[model samples]
Target: MDWQKNLLIAAIIAVLFMLVIRWNDFQESLPAANAPVSSAQQTDFNASSDAATAGDIPSLPGTTQAVPVANSTSTNVIKVVTDSLVIEIDPQGGDIVHVALPRHYDALNTPDVPFVLLDNRDHHTYVAQSGLIGANGTDSAAGRPLFTSAQTEYRLADGENQLNVDLVFQQGQTTITKRFVFTRNEYLVNVDYLIDNRSDSVWSGNLYGQIKRDSQSFHKVSALEMNPFLGAAITTNDENYKKLTFKDLNESEFRTVKQGGWVAMVQHYFVSAWVPDANQENNYHLRRIGNQDIYLLGFTGPRVEVAAGSTGSLSTSFYAGPKDTERLAEISRYLDLTVDYGWLWWIAKPLFWLLKFIHSFVNNWGLAIIGLTLVVKAVFFHLSATSYRSMARMRKLAPKLADLKERYGDDRQKMSQEMMKLYKTEKVNPLGGCLPILVQMPVFLALYWTLMESVELRHSPFFLWITDLSVKDPYFVLPLIMGLTMWLQMKLNPTPPDPMQARIMQLMPVVFTFLFLWFPAGLVLYWVTNNTLGILQQWYITRQIEKADTTA
Candidate 1:
């Protein structure tokens, strides 16, 4: 049947849709075949040879002078706990070496274990680093300044909305206080450098913040699963958002000067970003550290000068948490783009908004998905009706089409001519059955990305035996039902005349079922709902047309 050929084309387009959007990303992620393998041993923060150097910090706007690294020793670690965050700071640089989300679990089976977003262990080296750098900076090519905190650990008190953990470093007559202000239920931390210059000369330095991470993925995904972006991203004056893969950093350095922007390291469901003062002109940089696999993405604010015997403060914000679009947008202009819905963001955004709105009332993502499918179906009801009416008219002529095929057996050109005549006389569009699938392909793809990128859907439950919608259906029940609905939908349409084409069409459901077995349950649920609805509509339309013909 002509509908089968059109269906095959629609299926090919649907499957390759997302792949086409992410083709560049996929290419960038591919490792170079001739790339040299490093044999260096991994080291902890205290002894890591890939530590901060003068070259690591961005030079003054037009100056190329190198700043010397200070000679310092490692100090005690300061731990701070809030309702939403657990943070570990290295006093040596007042850097956030480790961060965990108390509200998010590391795994579904491990309720007590919080998800670690940043770590500085021997095996892993992802951490948030910040310090003063310039002619009068304390951090240098050799080492960073060692600071002292009032206590080894600090916890947010109940009923308190804000908590302050301060680390103090003394250099000659200058006292620099690094204060991290944490809110009771927020992931954004206010990092302020209160410089109390007691010396006769002025205190001048640039406050730089950066996230350093090795080119190692913490989350393991199968070869068949969709690989989320695991790299660096930034907002620039020219573009609202841009991404730099680890390989991109290795190939060349990325440098830009913008009034106010954010740099971040993005992963599957979470992100860590540094947002500088909106009024300050900051220099953003992304590059690999020497020949090592570690990459750094950060910004250096314009010089901050404190007069002799006076006090001044430089402030920035750091966010380490899930990629909540609304909260991220509140933090920076384009920070929310980190959620990354691909090229169909215009469509995906509204779909996500609708899904979220539905979930707000239903309180179940699965139910919300079904409601969303219904809304989408209703939106395209008239167009679908037109296509179904055409298909119904064709179905009424199926017996006649079979007779023509039998009469013109072994006569290819004659059969084609007769089929066209039949289609024209009956006013049935041979390709009309594919119109619905073609029109809905974008929505289908948008929903796929929406489900894949929305953090709220992570670990969300539907009903019995369906938990964690962000992952696959553990028992493969949804995929099986999705396949069954697909098969039934196919049955409602006229079978193809050619045996080989019919066989291929018959195997499509099986192929799609296996492909969807590893997809997120929320997405699979949406597909199943859409397919089931399609079957009902096709069957109803086909029945009405056949009954009318019989009556006539």
Candidate 2:
């Protein structure tokens, strides 16, 4: 009779689950809204140009082989190759036109083609641009200097650990030499402007660094999918990390004053940032560039006055690479915040640290996730022990509880009273299993986000069949195993007196299995490991309680 009741309840819940799934599918089938429209930037660069009286200062040259007004033809590109990076610079304004990471690829299976971080081709305008602005500077309202380099190609030779690409622009008696210094195994490039004020008059100006990007997603995401942030981020005096969306920049401009901070454009797994000298006061700005979908995040350095016949250099570091928190933290304060662990950062950070430590020894990310789950289970062992023991005691008294319920079958109020009295006398809590789960839910969610968002696990593989931990299990093996363990854990607990409650319990494993089928394999592996461990502990405690009861 109880089995009949359970079957009825299961059937009803299954119908409800099907309805929910259908509703989600229907919603996803709908058309998406239009993309954010472009708008013109409303900046006061003209006023600044007028005040500095450097309106004749040269603006940056176009990197996409844009025709110049002077010749309407010539274009120059300088190529630089290093151990880990390949970059292209346009001498027109000394802008970094293209950057590709040799160690990373464009896709999971594409090894020959490297991952490109910056480019100015195929209608995609993403590049790093910087130059001195204000008085006596090359960047001005009038024009931008087109620099001349000795060669068009340079490479980091064998046995060499550093390389320098220099471009120079001479205007009247003043000479501006822009040097881009690259190290063998580093993504941070030293972009320095050495201004030789050979002229009798003093030279004065400010340096500006900016990242310009259009509104095209580098990695395509579905409309109903949950995607990582793709926008502008800045470190401020008030907050460690602040995000300004492309839509936000389009609506209004953003400006702030900070002595030390960074302005960056962040995407799914990579970021490009302009980190100024910490000792200098800089003004940070975020705005959409003139009626296009392009947006700019940049900083203006403090005004500098170089004495006549003296050379003064203004330098800043630009990092364009993967979001490796450990390396980013060394570059600037709060730069690691770009990793973005969400509101659960406190829990996620420690979990990631422990996970990484485990991987150091095991040398496998999948095993590291299992080790992490075991550690979390051990930490909550005492609370879980208490909860499981309570449930075990209740399970031991299930026959008596069933007898009581049968005696008061027609009297609902009286049955409840008797159940409470029985729970008090036996010192058993029917709801004990819920509290520990509630306590650990946040930790579980944190670990999920940690695994899903960490780029280190982007294409990491485990044992057979699990190729990418950051995406779903290819054959649904892990999720099915997780569901099986969950069902076993349920078997060790007392059966619910209510047919509806029992039915819901039975359906939970199936529901969870369906939901986790799309979750990352790493996350599902954690769940399966945790559930298996819990089942073992609960089964052991249940057996011990039954033995003691029989002996007593």
Candidate 3:
């Protein structure tokens, strides 16, 4: 294909890819979620804290709670943290509070508190239930059948609740130990699995690690405000972001998606869990928080056929943390490649890289986003110059192109051919303006994903009102600037001969402005900065080229 056609195809391909992805998003809304809730269950949860009454609290997810630790203090040994991740492990149950964000919040404005209680440490979730892991809901949505039973075994002699958090299953001949470790600040959550096969003959079966229940915090609103975006979309019993998918092995009956693979379930949020292969072929299931169709995202590694009287062990990690951009870039090549977010990275990453540079200066993510924006404007002054010049040159050449067309009459092919010849004779690259615009696309996308998917950007702020860059622009200031910059850019560029097309193009700034109002502030900032740079570039190019032509 001609370079121009190829460029056009590339642009169209990028746009189409974006559209198809959005459609695919609707086609597969997060996997089937648990049942919303029963009227009776809602009534019970609303009554009061189970601290006052026994049996009032729901049971933990899978196993019946073990006998409550005899010591009262140890029952709530987990100290609530406000500044950072603090893990307090004693024999009794543990409390895991990601006190990173605010404890109190308005569901609409503020992001949810980021915390996943493996088992409600203090049983606030399952009030009065002292022993055995209880189920969150009657159905599959409450979370997979997770059996979390704790005993204050005498091994580690700290007498808190005398609790040892152990999630395992033991039958006569086979024992499965899936959960045994404590907390993780970053990277991965390690799980130790010991399978003992005591049968006289060889015993072979596939072990499994299934996500029974994953949850999201919701705003307890009145019956008036019940939307799925808020609450309406969930099932009767399962309301949070939860899913149940099988271990991905050689399950041919199930269709597998190639793009996301095993990590499909994880995006900006954190998710890592480990389980041994459970050969219960029928046990593969996939579920999400709001949808109803079950789909599986799992891995079935090697098959197991163990001889009699032998023990086997499997080790795995559960990653339930934020997705850091640079850290993930190094984590795997797939992660780095997937960072293609959109055009914003052309502006955001340099800001991040510069901030990382000055993070050498003053290590704060908030400051870095600010600093990054500043450095981007400085480095690309020349491109901005050329971009503006090209646009202005087109402006200068438009009247000529129009006169040539008018003289040529309605013969479009002849006129276009003449126009090209004239442009060449006059040393004008009719298509010179497109290259810079196209090259910036991938860089912009990469930064977009970096900002959206990175945990470092999560909860980080750039002053008041512009708190979270990951969510929609709060005050609309950034989006407005973006629109204004585009208008300025258009003012500097050559106008299309078709007045109607020009009018439509004139409206593009506003359309894009409104579209971006829902986008994160950081993204809008990048775009505004980029457009401003392009105008400067085009202006510079026009002046330089004109000078040489006049001298010639």
Using lDDT, give the best candidate's number. Answer: 1
lDDT of each: 0.84, 0.79, 0.44
Poorly placed runs, candidate 2 (over 4 Å): 1-75, 222-225, 400-411
Query: Native-vs-model 3 lDDT?
Result: 0.44
lDDT: worst 10-residue window of model 2: 64-73
Candidate 2, residues 394-474, lDDT tens digits: the string is 777789878987998778778878888888998877667656666787788788778866888987899888888888888
Worst 10 residues of 3 by lDDT: 227-236
Model 1 agreement with the true structure over 1-552: per-residue lDDT tens digits: 454456665666566565345534332243322234344532343344334443455566677735455334255689999999999998888889889997999888888989999987655668898999886787766568888988999999999999999999998999999999999889999999999999999999999999988877745556567778989999988889899889899999999999989999999989999999999999988988667667889989988899999999999999999999999999999999999998889999999999999989998889999999999999988788878887677667878988998999689778888898888988877777666667878888888899999999888888988889999999999999999998987777777676666787688799889888889999999999888888788788878877887899
Candidate 3 per-residue C-alpha lDDT over 374-396 given as tens digits, one digit per residue, 9 for 90 to 100: 56656655554555555666677
Candidate 2 structure lDDT: 0.79
Error of 1 at 257 (Å): 0.8
User: Which candidate, 2 or 3, would have the higher TM-score against the true structure?
Assistant: 2
What TM-score against the true fold does each predicted structure earn?
0.92, 0.85, 0.59
Indicate which candidate wins on TM-score.
1
